[model samples]
Target: MSTPSKAKRKLRDGVADIASLWNSVVENHKGENPALQQRNLGMISRVLGILPHLVALMFTAYIVWIARPGSSLFSWHPTLMCLAFMVFMLEAVLLFSPISSVLRGAGYTTKRQWHWMLQACAVAAALTGFAVITTNKYMAEKQHYTSWHGLLGLIVCCAVNLSVAGGVSVMYPAIVFNMPVMLLKRLHAIFGTVVFLGGMVTMWLGLCSTWFTNNVHHDAVLALCFACPVIVLLYVMVQVGQKIFRRRAH
Candidate 1:
């Protein structure tokens, strides 16, 4: 009945109306029209697509800065390997991503060409990094592949080279006429994913190395660096797995 009481009631009603409108929006986003939901998913995927590129670039830069490639022969190992696996190889894999590829607008043939080219760069960097570490170890009269990081890195390097060789067969299925081209592609994707994950694990192990532990004093920074590979690995796996499964289903 009073003027102030009437104003308070009006304000409460206005707040309730706003809350109801917000709830409607949230519910609509959750389960609206099928097409709208699909579009929203596409948008989310596209946004997430940029994540790997940013993470890879930042992580590689951090490692390179810490390694200071020119400081010592061993320093080049981490620097080059980080660039190889984290940057080049990641770009190569993402080139085919339907949602987030920078070349999503390009033809499949164009994407394939760039894919192999990027992969070649990755292989070159990896080999050079391997050689650097080998020479450094030799100069110091140290044993090779003594640590988990060293052994895994050796395996990843060899596997990556082999995977690239297999890609040739995928590119030219006639070379392996016995196997279906589709099958070859699937196999290549699976093998490549495994090798990529191995490389990431090796990178993580490298982080655990005495050099990294001594150099990186901040625990939070160390934790974030550790997560870099994990995020990339999950993104790649999800993308590759979805493609493989969708193909199989159809």
Candidate 2:
């Protein structure tokens, strides 16, 4: 072959190699984003999330089983109360489906935002449950039984929410999910931190600070329970933030 023709042939081969390499990179990227690869609650968390509802259902049945006209559970009010509790558990099942879908369908940005929204919703839902139970118990003059059952139910709710958070963190590493999920997670993390610290401070004020009163004991235990969620929120935020910042620095 002529010298000039040989040089042209070499250049053509080099271009083909580069094109092949680029195509491989693109294929790998697509592979990573497959629908089946979506972050989801692992098997254990799904089981734990359902466990409380099952236990609650059994306990409700037991209450119904043991009740007589004169017994606490047989009264019209307690029957209604137990029914409401069951309905709330059913509501949780309905809500969890959408929550799981959002977590799965969402890109990084949406996931982060959705996660924050979910957490906020969980906290609000918890508070709402507490308020409803407390007010109803006070009005019904069934504070003792109502308080115990309501507290147990709230604790179960918190456990499930916390487990969901854990599943998200474990299944989706903060760095990889960061770009697809984006800055929303960072913003949510910061906001969650602030919300948590503020909640803790407020609870302290209401329970042990100057705002506390003789009757505060009724609310004190519940207020203290709020600390766990606050701590979990802070920890997740810090770990996720660190992963994000490290990636950015790289």
TM-score, structure 1 vs. true: 0.84
lDDT of 2 at 217: 46
Candidate 1, residues 122-172: lDDT per residue as tens digits? Answer: 999999999999999999999999999999999999999889978999998
Error of 1 at 175 (Å): 1.7
- Candidate 2 residue spans exceeding 4 A from truth: 1-121, 124-181, 209-234
Please, what is the whole-model Cα lDDT of each candidate in the order they appear? 0.93, 0.45
Summed backbone clashes in each candidate are 0, 3
With a 3 Å backbone cut-off (N, CA, C), the pairs that clash in candidate 2 are 108-180, 108-181, 109-181
Output the number of the TM-score-best candidate.
1
Tens digit of per-residue lDDT, candidate 2, span 1-250? 9998998899899999999998996677566644434433354456544544454455445334433324532233333333333333232222323222224454665654554455545545445544554575677787443333344554544554554454355446573454454454454444444434343343233234222243234554445433433443343345446656875787
User: Clash pairs of candidate 1?
Assistant: none
Which stretches of model 1 miss by more than 4 angstroms? 1-43
Please give the distance, in angstroms, between residue 45's alpha carbon in candidate 2 and its true position after superposition: 20
